[model samples]
Target: MNTTETARRTAVLQSALAKQGIEALVAYGSGPRESAGMLRYLTGYMPANTEAFLVVPAKGRPVVVSADKNRARAFKTRLGDEMKIVKTTDLTGALKEEVASAAPRGGLVAQAGEFDMTTALHAEFRAILEPYEVTDGYGIVTGQRLKRTAYEAEKHRQATAIADKLVAHAMSIAAIPGVTGPDIMAEVEYLGRRLGADQAGCWLAVGERPAETYFDLFELTEAVGPNARVQIGATVCLDGYYSQVLRIGMFAEPSDRMKEVSERLIAMQDAALARMVPGTPIHEIVDALETMIDAYCPYTRLSDPFRFQSTHAMSNSYSDPGAAPFLNAGRDKSRDAESPLVAEHQVYEVHPNFTLPDVGHVCAGDVAVVGGSGATWMSQYPRGIVRLA
Candidate 1:
């Protein structure tokens, strides 16, 4: 991300903290991948090894505390010059010193986020930052992130464009004889990088039991064969944003049932888009989508009766931990009702997938923004089954 984007995010976060009565956000990152969510949102620093923390006080300049001197040094050279950067073995002491001036009105909070920290680490973190009430208030910041700046919206468009191209490329080669699963994987990865992605990844299931393999996520043991339907999922990361898409690649003529199911999936997504109006409870939409799925789907997945999530929030860190609008809305009616309203500007990946008697896991998915009247597609491609041959 550019300096402007970081500055805008920092300013917005500061305002949000002030509103939530949160003194600061102690976003923790055990490694670079972990850093990609909250920590990187502020410091522009992805920790190489050891732990890193970005402390953002409501009324003060943010600071980055890192145990990794090497990565910290590199961050300074590349991006951390605006914020205070302290390389230290005493991470907690550094954090304490930074937040010392803030009044103890709002609680001090930390974000171990999606991957909650190990018990030992959590105890240590709680112990050293004593005398103040510490809480998991990451939700406050996540709620704020639901609204994206114009910069983020544009980046999201570009990111999804990469994945669209990837799916297209895979389809172009699907009918080629002698093409294997690895061939498509290799081509997609190479093409993704060539298209200027920070990272590109794919999950595929081809051959006879394609649905079963696709259900397994990374299944690619079987080769692409004639008359086989290929179930594929693709993700591409560019800048700090990521995009995802899923589609079925069929080498033979699709059955009438396949076309009908594909159309139903499209209508399902349309129903989902209508629910993305700002301030609507996400759980309401999720419940509605589940009803649609249950009503439309008649058969179990090839391997078993299990089914995957129908939808989720997506953007930074893929399904972002630092963003609200998650599908896992809390269970309690009181809490679940309050579980992340459908805020404007959040991106969600809606992929309703299920298996058929003859076809494997048929899927149609895309990334879209929740704004204006409802969700708008960031993914600009065909939404149904892609006939390759």
Candidate 2:
């Protein structure tokens, strides 16, 4: 993140704090996963080998807490000395002191995120805030992340470009006479790492779709056979931002039934994509999508044998069934589909996919951006199945 962009994002969060009358905001990030997403958004700090925390007040210098002095020093040099980097052996004491500086005695303090935090870490975080009135502050960050800035979109594009190559290579390798799913994924990983990707992962399913819709990568030992109906997906992260490409390809020409279903699935996805207008309610889109999908194939995401959805939101986090843009039944009724307006620049991974005995899992999806007037495709690869014959 550049200096200007960093300042812009921090200002947005601080403005939220001021509006909510919260004294200080504590953001927890534990070791390089989705939990680190908020910390990265506010401070451009990605947790390397250890857990870290960012404490930002409505008005004051933000403090970043680190356990490793070497890691702190390296990040300081890379990020410059604009913000304070505190090397703390005593995490609770440091957090309390920093909170004291920004917050008034007996004032309210809000936490940015906690759902993904480890249990022991969560207890420690809560222990520090137990003195003050606390409220959930995740909405504050989720609001900002779902919208893609030109900078974030650029990173997504770079990741998606590499993801495209990964998918294409996997499909081509499947056409070879003898190759297991893992064999192809090994080459996919090497290709992604060689091209400057930070992290890469892929999923594979060959032959007719199994009884279950969700396919596990660990059990992907089946060899690619002639005319095997293959479904594969590839995702890579560039600077904590993720991009993915999913496709269904065949070694032989796709059967007529397969072609027809692929077109229907893509059309169903388009209908939902076009409904993503700014200011629209998130649930309204979900309801409309379900109705359209049920017209051809009766569906409800909640009842899935695997907890997947027809569409989902994504940002720096690589976790599945993302938060905002689409919310399921949960504690935060406010964030449920019925609430939360679709922001102007929201991003989503749209896939109205399902399994069929005739064609296997019909996976086809792309990253979508809702900007300017309507929806636009972030992945250069058009949404459809491929035939390598």
The C-alpha stretches of model 2 lying farther than 4 A from their native spots are 32-34, 69-74, 146-148, 210-217, 298-307, 319-338
Candidates in order have lDDT scores of 0.71, 0.71
lDDT of 1: 0.71
Q: What is the TM-score of each candidate against the true structure?
A: 0.85, 0.87
Off by over 4 Å in 1: 18-23, 31-36, 44-50, 77-80, 89-115, 213-219, 299-304, 321-326, 329-334
The best candidate in terms of TM-score: 2
Which pairs clash in the backbone of model 2?
283-337
Would you list the clashing residue pairs of candidate 1?
A: none
Tens-digit lDDT string for candidate 2 (20-74):
8998888877666566777767766575467777888888767888877876785
